[model samples]
Target chain A: MRRFSAYEWVRTAVTIGIALALGYLVLVFTVDDPNGAFKWFLWGPLSRMRRIVELIDYTIPLIFAGLAVSIVFQAEIFNIGAEGQLFMGAVGATFAALYFPQIPVIHVILVAAFAMLVGGAWASIPAYMKAKWNASELVSSLMMNYVAFFLGLYFINYHMRDLKAGYLVSYKFPETAWLPRILKRYNLHAGVFIAVGFVFLVWFFLYRTRFGYEIRMMGFNKNFAMFSGIKVNNVVLYAQIVSGMVAGLAGAVELMGLYKRFVWQVSPGYGFDGIIVALLARNNPLLVLPAAFLVGYFRTGAYVMSRMTGIAPEIVTTLQAVIILLITAEAFLEFWKRRKIIREAMKAEGGDVQ
Target chain B: MNEIARSILSAEFVYSVIRVSTPLIFAVMGALLSEIAGVINIALEGMMLMAAFWGVIVSAFTGSAWLGMLAGLASAVLLALALAYFHLNLRTNLILAGIALNLFASGATVFLLYLISGDKGSSASIKSYVLPRVDIPLLKDIPFFGDALSGHHILTYLAFAAVVFVQYLIYRTPLGLRLRAVGENPEAAESVGISVRRVRYIALVLSGLMAGFGGVFLSMGYVSWFARDMTSGRGFIALAAQALGGKTAIGGMLGAMLFGLAEALSYTFQAIRIPSEFTNMMPFVFTLIALAVYARSVIARHRKAPSSSQPLEENTET
Candidate 1:
């Protein structure tokens, strides 16, 4: 198993290298100053301590979202509603922060709890539909995202709109609900600790628990798990709800740790980014940390590159897409493995003749 | 109440419904074809966005809507071919590949738009050719129906015609039989000399073409320019429509119309002080409800007669 994993690691590294080279070629074709663009894309984040700190801050939600997706994926449920759940979490946290300004330490805790509850509630609808009707959670969860987005927009535009603000903005979150920054100089907050803690917690839960084993079994084969007396419906429901709660917590953390108010026009695609992170990590909770950081580093560097080079930051998105496509192409790895096996067999035949 | 009734009953409302449903109908047809062939083309959203962007750019450059549409179709087909190669030949997870492609389309379209137009939001500066609206000569003279049916873009009429075409192709052709056989049991079909991969490729290509038409209509017929992420969630809505339609072409059309009506009603409702957000959410919420209801009915039927004909299992593989 270790040798196979090492082989998989090598294959993954090679795929990533190829994807990056292709992306650089695309940049060369599109941009006049390809060298400058490439420099900024590859090294801008590492060139500054502030940028590195920002990358760390951005990776917090990514870690949570990755873990969220990995959890549901383990149960073989495609609950893509993390995007919606995150939005709903922001809404919940904002509501709590704005409405209960009197409470100090408790207010922050309450807001976090509310975010998780709202996120879980949002996911439960799709979970219910899937459990009861065998309806495609993929479709329902996806459709629900728009509803959640628009609903969040409505709340910000109407109910919580700060009329004095020039643009559409929500009322400032109360000071009492603010999460303390760990590194005040760089604006890093306590959420990073929570994110790191979740890595170990999720790893333990997925690797050591009986429930996690059931989830893994179900993911491996639903019929076999069902015949083995696993209650598939309840497991699916629990997995989706827990996944949503984690995503919701990410939103709440982002809001309290970064923004002063509800200013999100649309989800920043953190949920989708989490999907890629989970995929890169092969759904391993512990591996999600490095995966999220790698993605965050790319994003930060891309942002700086676009700012410096007058290119759109969306170039990073294109690169991410290429990486995802290459990584997920199963045949690429298999083809190479087959060739290696054939070569080894030929060598063995030659040795026997000698 | 009287205001609601007046707006709902107006000829303009019916026209709006038809106009709104046109692109959705195209996407639904595309999704239905792919789903029936056991390849769920969730990349319809990306394909539509790519076509929409290219269709507008090409029309702007060439000064011809037809040429623009051909370019759009070609672009979608190219993406579809890539999807087929990666998913079928490479044995990648189809959903993951589709998602990646959708992300690629979303970013690439905006990136390309910015490079060419110097604007990330839209292509409003470019003067693109719009598809001409056609009024049926004899039909335009009809009393009540004239106002509702006449003077729509040519693509709208084609959308309806394509429904009939798709239905005929899927039901009456030997190709359709082989496609269905391949989807139901690929090994069995292979033994009988049907190429499953080839059928899937054809289905994906046809799906891409229909999605291309939808994208072209969005840019050229619905509006004269492409906006970033303008296809919005319509592609996903079409997927819902396909599922709600039970994988039948005609039913998909009806489902698309229902969503279109919801959108049109939302537009009207906005004038009456209803929150546009709630109205905007109606179609998706309605889809969820419709799906649940459909599932319940199917379950009830199963319980009533265990050995009865299974109607909802046609596209359950994905």
Candidate 2:
């Protein structure tokens, strides 16, 4: 494991502090009740047990989504189709749930398997193109996202739509298909345990296994990995498929855990939010849980704050963008780091002017 | 079936195709310039969205379409410069920065819309100026072609004019050569005393300017108002068009037209029994197929001449 220096920690804290300050400043200018907005923004999620449970529920899928993106990113494949993959996953799970309404344990297993299959299949298209033609996975994945979204919409609107609901939503799953809620009063479900389990599993897969080592090697230097007989194309393909499976499972989990029916708008930018979560965690699987929880807390707080103060919930989105921009900036603390290095070197060379 | 055929053949449908394609043409042209300059301006969506909002808001306030266009252009250019700064100077990951900017634009535009017009869905509460349409004097006399070609928004005409201008600027100008040089071989260009960063910045700014026109047209001409996420996925389609066109201005225009044709057909199909979702999926599916075919052809051509080196090989790196 690599150790983070004090300077690194300070810089991260300072950057986050600056981002929060800027967000608060925007709130003060736009919101009528700045103090209340700020208060909710900081602590609303923690204010009530129910809200805290909702935050945990929200974080469950986010953890999986983050892990999905992180896995593909580690293999240096820019797959932005996680959103589409998740949509497909939901579609697959919905089909399984609606069709096999009996045999509770078997039904849940089949739903998850179908979700993984659909998501992995959706992702393989771009992965195949990248492996064979060296076509950009980014563009292909993005294009596939729209395709998946529309396909999912078509399935729901034409096949599964519940006419009695007065909205474009799917028929409700049988009670046997629903994942049990962990907390009786709150929204918390068994999916949170699965999410935590996967975090450790992914960490093990990415670090302890030979395939994981090869993925890391390929990401570090594709040419070197190729020369070292790592079968770069296969690795890329597998990494993408695995990533898609995780994203698909996230979608399935979200559906089973929270909704009785497959809602038309299944994703509220969960895939994109995963990107931010992964980046915040420095693409470390172990860090994804906490990072996702942090985002979940902020998102819940934003919802509470907006509801109370009439401020748009999009304020959280703006804050997220600002934070991402600041954190990704390579030049943010380079000068300070360089100065520190120089100072240390000078101290080592004291009284030895040659 | 006869009615469908008649509608498809009518000049009105052709005119609609051109009108729908106008914004895409501008965006594809922008994508072409930036891609050639080695900077993938995926933030085209964000820039266009910001421009669309600002253009409508400014026109509503000023009652001048021209001023609104300028405001839109300025706003897009500002965003482009910021993208260049973060990607080039600050050394941020370009794709991540673009995505961040897009998220920022998506949220900020709606926030600003709510703040100003008190409506998050659209700027329809404000009476925005609509861009004027121009009919070619002599061209209007031509029977079949006249109806299809004349009486378009001035920006639509400018979009076509931009195709030629971009073609000339890229292939015939010294700046174009330098930009291409900087993109193709930055080390060689630097050794020859070219400022790589400066060229990239200029390309990005020009790209932003073109995309700005597209955005202004979306609000001021296409619909006369700004809606949340109005540009939709046109920006991504433009990028796909750039890819399909082989990063050339004329090719990009043709690609944009093809996608526009698909979009126009989707609209037509909506009137028929086809589900709107399938129709909506057409352009993206078309893009994927186009890209796949383009990639396959290039690969085939390379295989055909295995030993011979091609000058254009470098352009295919993207």
Off-target runs (Cα >4 Å) in candidate 1 are A1-4, A339-354, B307-318
lDDT of each: 0.87, 0.86
Each prediction's TM-score against the native? Answer: 0.96, 0.96
Error of 1 at B123 (Å): 1.0
Lowest summed-lDDT stretch of 10 residues in model 1 chain A?
A1-10
* Residue-level lDDT tens digits of model 1 in A239-349: 888889999988899999888688888677998988888888888898899999988888898888888997888877877887778777888778678877899899999
Query: For residues A185-287, could you state the per-residue lDDT of candidate 2 as single tens digits?
Result: 7888888888999999999999999888888889888899999989998998989998999999988888888986798563468888888888787778998
lDDT of 1 by residue, B137-165 (tens): 98889876898999999999999999999
Model 1, position B181: C-alpha lDDT score: 80
Query: Which candidate's DockQ is highest?
Result: 1
